[model samples]
Target chain A: MLAKNKKSLIIFIILSLIGAAIYLFTLSDSFMYQRDIGKITHVSEGSSQRTEDEFKNVDHQHEQKITMIMLNGKQKGKKIHTHNSWSNSGAFDQKFHSGQQVFVDLQKQNGRTTAEISDYKRDTYLLMLGWVVISLLILTMEFKGLKTLFSVVLNFVVFLLFIELDVKLNLTNFFWLFVLSAFIFTALSLLIVIGWNKQCAVTFASIVIGTTGALMIGVLVLNYTGNDLHYEALDFATQSPKQLFLSATVIGLLGAVMDAATDIVSTVFEIKRSHPQIDQKQLFGSGIEVGRAILGPLINVLLLIFFAETFAMGVLFFRTGNSIGYTFEWTMSLGIVQSLISGIGITLVIPAASAFAAWAFRKEGQVENN
Target chain B: MKTISILTVILAFLMVLVGGKQGFSAFFSVLINFLLLFLNIMLISSGFPPLWTSLFSGICILAITIYMGNSDEKSSNVAFLATLAVMVVMLLLIVPLDHLVQVKGFANEQSEEIEAFNLLVGVDFEKIAISTTILSTLGAIAEAAIAIASGLNEVIEQDPQITPLKLRKSGQNIGSQIMGMTFNTLFFGMFGGDLALFILLNKLHNSFGYYLNSKIFVSECMLVLYSAIAVILVIIVTTWLMSRKVRPQRSA
Candidate 1:
């Protein structure tokens, strides 16, 4: 145990050092628009508070003198001075600390370039956080942890590739693309985790059927209620709003459905292993009972996630003195609707997975009987 | 809004049709749990402190879900205590992490929306961020804790003479199976929730690096990590609680 601890410590140190090196030195290439990398050198306070009558009691505002040194692009190694205002309320007003890296977007006029801080260089921090999570996972579960991490990376890679394909193809019918991608994702993810087995097959079938059933239910509810699927809360959409909503619904339900199915099937498999003489009818009944126990909490998980994402917007609306009715209608209504739809999917998966597991396990029983 | 009501009615009807009375009770519990969440948010908006509001609602949701989902008092008690314990620990971690990450408030792109409203309502966006993270993670953590606790209890009940070590092993096995599914649920849920934003990023021709640095993306990622951490911690806590509880009974 001591040696194992020492080995994990060494691995953690090495990973951390590597992460720090990458964060400090790695330079990102500019995208379609040119951008210069800069580090904050100095900050001086200007305005200290908001004087507006309504804001006097409620706002924390600070104007600051900011100095930065350009690290890349044509303005490499040049010093620039800029003004920044920090507001507690505004969306973009940020309080920048010294030594933080920022992306400087420059404009050229009258033979001189003026730069403004567009956004902070935040990827390094994200990488650092990723390292922490990965290291902890590795330390705890070891080999299985490593495999889980691999599948996670693979899931992301697959998702990115699907997004890239969707962009290139410019598909008008996003429903098919999303459905196909969901299928591929479900197959690969289950295969990677559980491998090619009867359990995996059962889970895959249940997930597909469950998510599809939920998607159909979502569509029916949307159509029957005559609810406009226009998601104005989301910024600029290039595709049809309805299509976007549908695609989001499908993607969201996929994980929960798969999770519910996997949970029920795995439990049933365990039961089968322990009670080898149990008949198919009894096994199926047990699976359904397990699903029932899990469905409530699982649905709550999805609902909380969906609502939590929109919580801030809802609060902001209410903070502005909007009525509860208006705030609920405008800010959280869509999220609530989405959660309910996903809940339907999660709920349906319970029986779907049970039936699939029952069928698969029954087949094995028949084989043994012969 | 109308759609939510309609969906709720439909879900309640279906739950009854499928699981009979217990299903209806579960559906009602979930419905009430959602209302509690809605009311909590309303309370926060009505000037209640975000922290207390979250704590209150978290407990209420945990109790309602566990009690309604599991018929046995012993199982519900174990689940509730284990879940609450884990939630407290997760919330403690969230405070410091929220400060370190500093991805609070709306993204710059959301300025237009904020501009349309009064920005001086004096609400601390930092607290809002922490509260939102806690609220979002509460459900996943509670669900995982309940699942593991009740699962271990079921194993123990079947073989009451099972040793503590064996119970712990089974608990670990159960946890391992559930962890992957729980993590994926969170990942896909976030992915699906933010699909439109991703498409926007794609359409705007933002580079991969830009997508990573984007505020919304970063916050969403942070939310995923927070919940993941909560799930991990809950598994450990539930296992430990189950093992400790089973030992005395086994010896007796």
Candidate 2:
């Protein structure tokens, strides 16, 4: 077993290195086409003379001066200077740093070379790091870790596949896609990690009941709330907007909430296994206690994970003196509502997951008695 | 039935009354934390770099974690200290990655949304986009911190004799239990909102390789990693913190 395991480890590392190489190669090529190398000669804070009405309501607008290093060819080694507007936007923030190397878009007008800071190559490299870490984790964990890591890789692939299908095929039926992704991701995640077994089956069943049932509740609540509370402040896509936002909310909550539900259910079942004499009421109470313990932290989990990504926007609002209500309405409100719904889903799943586990194992016990 | 219902109501009322105060404080922590994110974005919009924005965000997360941790004063202070230490460690790990990754803008998909809203309301779309991404992960970071701190506190309480090594092992064991589900939570939580995007991206025959490489996809995935790493860091640090405090207290 040890020898076989070692062999598998070698295989995993080889495969990971290949993936890393491919990822790195693609990254180098993508950014090489549009390079904007520059250095920040001066950094200063400047306010927009333009009202909110000016500049197309960009998420963040920053005035920064950049001394261009080299754009494309001949004078590439030479440092040409220019001033450019940088935003809190992800790409520009990377390019327009002080006294740092940058690659910007160069425009030639009347023999003077000018560069506008564009895409940041750093993002590609950061992503490479994320993948590399994941690969290393899989290689290290060997079996269980590899399984979990594979589940992550699998979900990413499924998500990519699903995204392309929706965009290219232009599937108007958004609801089905939501359901299918939820089912497939949840099942695959559980199957790949936990494997096929009665316990795994129970966990799977609980996840379905817990996640789906909670989702139904969430959908009902959203409908009841009239969707007015849904933060339209988020720059949701307009062309196929409503459907897209709905899908995003559903998919975001599905994994975390479902995972929480399964964990709680299986945990209670494990407790029962060790203490078989523990009765149904005791089992039920244990489930509730577990749920209670996790409830606050779990909500925080979703709230922080979902909202952290958007912190840049929230900070912009407060700094710009946008009213708290105004900021909430557009920026943080939708996330709040989403987190709340997931919270409710998670809270309800406690009972649902536990109840299903209780029923399954009890039935199994009866069969054993017979 | 009436008795059970009444008892249930009373229990909830107490839980809220007890947990409610914590809840309110948590709410404020969240609110202040949100404000900090908005501030970072505005600062970034006004020409401060994302590195600064991320630093400010880190301080705010630390403050909020401390505030939320200190709510109970007596008991929770320990949790708070542990949580704060964990958060600091996480910040050390996560802040560098933000720099290294240099994720600079929102996906093009979001640009249209920003532009449309920009036309209507006159808000700077770029600032809005940056703030949104940063804000999205803050809640998760705080939650993970609390989990690691609180979980470590519980472990130490159960086994006061837990040596430093044992405590670290215990924390990791418990964290493994928590992470078994928590990692999944981070994973699905990320793509959860954009289900349609997944369908669209897939239908277009966007390969796994391509999506893995896409800016937006990578950003979301990294955030998940950041959250997971933050959670792990919290576990390690809190274990250390708890051992320091617990060891002294026991000796005293």
Candidate 3:
């Protein structure tokens, strides 16, 4: 126990120190950027301006008096005062305040220095949130939580590499590339969670099988029926909308599919371990039972996630007087489509999970019988 | 439109075909959930406080998801309470973190799509951000809570005389696996959902430091982290509650 305490204390101190270092790094990292960065040390409201949008509603807008100290560039440590307008909705304009670091556009006229806030220097806060999460994981889970965090970070690296690869390849055959990525993601995540065991292999095989099975059916149906997907409402996606959506669908299915497959496999294995004499038939039956229980929660999880993604835009569409159908068409149609595909994956994974799990245990059961 | 209808039908049929009644209920729960989210959006747009509206919606989702997905009264109840506790903890964590992170409203990437629409929606973008954070993580928290509670319930049922130590170990065992799987789910969900945006950022040649600080990237990262944090908290809360409920306390 003393040794365990010392180990975690060391880990805890290291994580905290890392967090502090990142926080300071974000403050100093501004020098590499061409744009001048500043933190608003004082802010005062200037005025409120009312304007009309395309919807013809009177919008309230305001401005602030900002006194900022430049964090980097030739004007480092120099104080600049400027103000910018903001709207209540902040749809396009932004609201800035004291202690918030921002990217600034600096101007010097007649030896007078002035700056305008361009963007927020938010890396510090992001790192803060990341550290909070890692700290909690460490405090609660100790070394195992560290492993989980490491695995997640590893998956993130792999994902970034996948993205980089897709980009370096210039988006050719993107969907197939993502399908390959799905395999890697599933295998890596399962290997980390379950380690290299019979159970891990079974879970991985079932996830791949289930995901691909669903994709084939989904793709075939989309092709046979002709694509009716709307690409107009896509945000900042300058690629082939269909390809983006398809890739998104494939990756989305990975998480939920892994979730369902793991649950089914773990439950099946647990039942087998606790009851050695349990036949493969009963074990498979029990796996299906576990699948049924998780069915609703699984779909609900996907729906909530997808809806939240599009929820803000959907609301803005409605607030602007767009009908529900149009809003649904514009903001939510693709998300729903993605969810349906994932739903199919979740649905198919159940049988794949039970079948693979029971089969993986069959030889073990036969040996026991002998 | 035609594709959505056909696919919906096929999904419904398959869900029923595999999950049977559970699938049917799952189908309803999903339908109700969509409607609830729709209502949430509507209320916030109509000038309801975004934070309050989303809180109400999160509570409803938690209740409906727990009761509908679970048939056992005890496990569902315990899960509900544990999930609510986690939600409160999440809300506390989110409000301050959101303020510091400053990732509210439409992102810079969204400027083109939303520029011409409107500016005066009479809503708090910051509060909407908070609302979104809360509601998004509700599913994972509730799901983990139900899994742990029900799993522990079964363990106790199997051996009614099990000590608190054994029950605690089992809960940890169950919680740890679920935690790992849930992390995978949230991480992939974030990656898959944001792949398009990442590609966009890469094309823009936004440096890694710039992307890390951007509203789009930070917001997505925070969403995943929030869900993950909530799920981990759920495991702890559910495990502790289960052990306590199952164990009889002696006077100290």
Calculate DockQ per candidate and list them: 0.56, 0.25, 0.64
The true-versus-predicted C-alpha distance at residue B220 of model 1, in Å, is: 1.1
What digit string (tens of lDDT, one per residue) describes model 3 on residues A1-370? 9998898899889988998898888777877777788878999998787777666656688988889888888888988889888887765567887877888887778988767777888787777778888898888887678878888888889888988888889766688888888888888888887788888888988898889888998888889878577865666686787888888888887898998898888777765665677788887887787677677777778788888887678778888999988888889888887788888899999999999999977766532210
Q: Rank the candidates by TM-score, best first.
A: 3, 1, 2
In the range A193-215, model 1's lDDT, one tens digit per residue, is: 67787888889888877788877
* Stronger candidate by lDDT (1 vs 2): 1
What's model 1's TM-score? 0.91
Top-down DockQ ranking: 3, 1, 2
Can you tell me the DockQ of model 2?
Answer: 0.25
Query: Tens digits of per-residue lDDT for model 2 on B1-252?
Result: 222223223323333443445544544454565456555555665556655566567656655655563343433455455555655554565556555555534565456544433322233334344344444544554454455455555445445666776666555444544555566777778766655444445445554445544556666666667666555544455556656766676666
What CAPRI-style quality would you assign to candidate 2? acceptable
Q: List residue ranges in candidate 2 displaced over 4 A.
A: A1-118, A135-142, A225-240, A273-277, A315-322, A360-370, B1-82, B104-174, B194-218, B235-252
Best by lDDT: 3
Query: Pairing residues by index, what is the TM-score of model 3?
Result: 0.93
CAPRI class assigned to model 3: medium
Q: What's the TM-score of each model vs. the native?
A: 0.91, 0.69, 0.93
Native-contact recovery for every candidate? 0.53, 0.33, 0.58
